[model samples]
Target: MKATPADQQELLRLQSIDTRLQQLAHKLGALPQTAPLAELAQRETAVRGTRAEAIGALEDARSELTRLESDVAVVEARIARDTDRLQHTSSVKDVQALEAELASLAKRRSDLEDQELVVMERVEDAEVVVSSIDLQRAAIESEVAELEAERDAAAGGIGVEREQTERDREVVAAGVPAELLAFYEQRRARGAGVGAALLRQRTCGGCTMTLTGSDLEQVRRSAPDDVVQCPECDRILVRTDESGL
Candidate 1:
């Protein structure tokens, strides 16, 4: 395919734009915050599970405390009725029985109060555990929000540049002959995004290999309008003053 020398040079510009766009896409996907954000999500899930266990422990402690309180209440009620009877009765036998029963009730109340104290401590400890887990979860959530904001900001900047680059490509591509542009596109797809390169200082710019011997002689013999492809890389070679032919 024959394209004017000027038209061929525009392919290098198009290639540069395409390369920049590819770099921008890679940068957007590789933002530093992406990995940490994913890690934070997993941490939050584990903390939630721990919080659930702590809550269950607290509930169990509270239930035990409630049972102990009820037991103490029943013991105190019995002691009160027995003391009232002792005050009214005059028989010596009844006095002894009432005194003994009062002593047993006092012992039972003391034991129940002791049990309640222990269970109350357990409840307090359980509450502390739950509170600590809540703080951990909150911290993870805060970090996640921060990272998401950073990621979004970075993506927004890249997106703006990409849009402008695409516009630039459209303008540059419009000037090329239809046949040449289509041919370049096909070569670009097969050549890793590079359809044309400058033949600079006796080197094939596409492959960065210097042309020598018959290869150099062949390119030197070609006409200015001839579409020459590199024997090594098959990319269209656009010659210029720097080609060093």
Candidate 2:
């Protein structure tokens, strides 16, 4: 359909507004704080850190247990050697000295065994903690996967909408005069996506301010096909049949 230069300009302005609106929607959708994928990623990072700490603790516990066992073995060997010495020594003085050494070795062995038992218990507790953490990590991974899938689906939908909006913009852009389009773009850049609005009831929608009686009269007398800009907002004002005043 044939469109007047004024109509074409208005259409272009509408297209620009729609394009900006679509971009705003995309920007909002992709925000790190708002996007499900980003939140999932943060959670994944935390889970990984927790798992690392759990693994470290488990390893430390195992190492402590191993060390304690080795110490117990050394103490037991000392006890065995002292017992053999006590049995073989013939002189009364030598036997008495050997008995004293054996007694000390026995006490040391007992202490080492007790410590080893404590370490073994700690190892068991650590293993349980590791197992529980593994399960928690697995559950978090599953949730992350679900969130990624959801995010992908949502982004796909937004992509389709973006493509449609771009197509619509192209169609609308083809109708506008290049000079008018340039003017609107400049105004839009200055005013943050609000470069044009319908003038209604003697008010400029761009500024939300009513026009003076003289200005209203002047605007009314202006040619219908002419492009008019709001003096206050510098936004192109479209006069409409539905303007109440």
lDDT of each: 0.90, 0.73
Q: How many backbone clashes does candidate 2 have?
A: 0
lDDT of 1: 0.90
The lDDT leader among the candidates is: 1
Kindly list the per-residue Cα lDDT of model 1 for residues 48-129, writing each as its tens digit: 9899999999999999999999999999999999999999999999999999999999999999999999999999999999
Q: Which residue runs of candidate 2 sit more than 4 Å off their true CA positions?
A: 1-53, 160-245
- Candidate 2, 1-245: lDDT as tens digits: 23354674465467465657658586757754355666667777887888788788879988987887787788788878878877887889988887888788788878878887887888888888878877877887787777666666656767676777777777776777777677767877777677667777878777887888777777777776777777788877777764554
Question: Which pairs clash in model 1?
Answer: none
RMSD to the hidden true structure, all candidates = 9.2, 7.8
Native-to-model Cα distance after best TM-score fit, residue 191 in candidate 1, in Å: 1.7
